[model samples]
Target: MGIQTIPGYMTRGIVVNGHGQRFINEDVYPGLVGIEALYRQGMDVWVVLDEEAFEDVPEAERWGLQPPHVAETVAELEKGMGLPEGAAVGGDGAAVFTLGGLATDDEGRVRDRDGGPIAGPYAAGRASSGLHGGGYISGTSLGPGTCFGRRAGCAAAGAQQ
Candidate 1:
């Protein structure tokens, strides 16, 4: 829908012509959601990913370089990941592609270095309950303030409870 220029490259696009064989891109923004809908309509995808697209996101949330064929192999999982009667792995098997995932628990909840809760779901500076940081542990290198923040909140909550 718009064009943006990064330091190195510029992505310029426009509504050239809308009609297609049977499918349309629907949205011009690279960050638009529901990619499978386009797939369902027989449109093969060509994602041109780069750093600026993921700049604001936490490092853990980014996918570095999954093989190009990974999406092809995982195609069955895209449409709900469930099988008709045989059961399947697409619908609920650690599924990892959705729009709201950035704000939701897809990247896992943040917990403290101890077995305590930290900031809820910041992309950074807080510990994680499920996801691992660049360090060797599930919770490390994050700002300790987040852990104490939860502690104080928990104390207040306990007093009220």
Candidate 2:
């Protein structure tokens, strides 16, 4: 069963795949991204948090959550989580997911493989591939989108003129 967790659940700890090794950034998109990593490792992963990081989490945020498998140190956390000894883990399945989007021009116009802009249809924000060609940057999921969305909208509006 999946747990509704606060973002802090990720920012504070490290995440490891089924093999108990760090794969992607702990704070990556936080959903499909992390899940994909899990699939890559072995489809079963764990989050190991040290007592200090666990305690640092706010009580309110932990609301309605299962008590974390407690451990005083990393080794214990790994053992508790059934990971290999000394395995570093956290946010087992929280990294956000990102996929390559429709290729777009600077004006947010979708382009074909031949680099020709597709007529009429346009994309912006995460829907457009320009901002994040292969990967994404944290905290940028929205800003560029808003800006590009506006540009696309304006361009679309003018094209209708």
Candidate 3:
């Protein structure tokens, strides 16, 4: 299971890799952060925040984790975390789902490379690419998933009958 971090925590901090190099911009959606972290830093990533940034997070959004490690300096924090001398820091980011999927028609039929619907194998929801293009907005999949999933189901049912 993955621990979900709140947007407030993500946007207010800088994400660094094991080498203490800053990567993605912290202002975008947290999903994008997860993707970039996985691609650029593998699993060795951390979000570094200042005192104000840490305090800005509401207690409820902390996911019941213990208080963050306090340190007088970045080197001190890195030493405590067992990282290299310059490495910066937490919240392990795990991608919940990918953004893109199989191309599908309105009826949820899978689309071929030539842009025609395949004969069988209808896909919907996260299984097929629908609303998302490049970036993701939280909860954006729910509406399209329901509508397209129903269309796919109805189409499949009609074909069966």
TM, every model: 0.19, 0.47, 0.48
lDDT of 2 by residue, 1-161 (tens): 23234546655765565456755555544564445544565556445455577678777777756545776676776676677775553434333443434778878788997899999889986666323423456666588778888989999999999
For residues 53-140, could you state the per-residue lDDT of candidate 3 as single tens digits?
8787888877664434577887887876556774433443433455445788889899997889889899987677534434666788
Candidate 1 clash pair list: 80-91, 81-90, 81-91
Q: Per-residue lDDT of 1-161 in model 1, one digit per residue for the tens?
A: 21222211212111111121112232322333123323342233323333444354344544353213122332332332221323322232222321121221223344443535445433323322223322234334344436544554565465456
- Report each candidate's C-alpha RMSD, comma-separated, in the order given: 15.7, 12.1, 13.4
Per-model lDDT: 0.31, 0.62, 0.69
Local lDDT at 143 for model 1:
42
Q: TM-score: which is higher, 1 or 3? A: 3
Ranking by TM-score: 3, 2, 1
- Against the true structure, whose TM-score is highest? 3
Query: lDDT of model 3 at residue 136?
Result: 68
Candidate 3: misplaced stretches above 4 Å?
1-4, 87-161
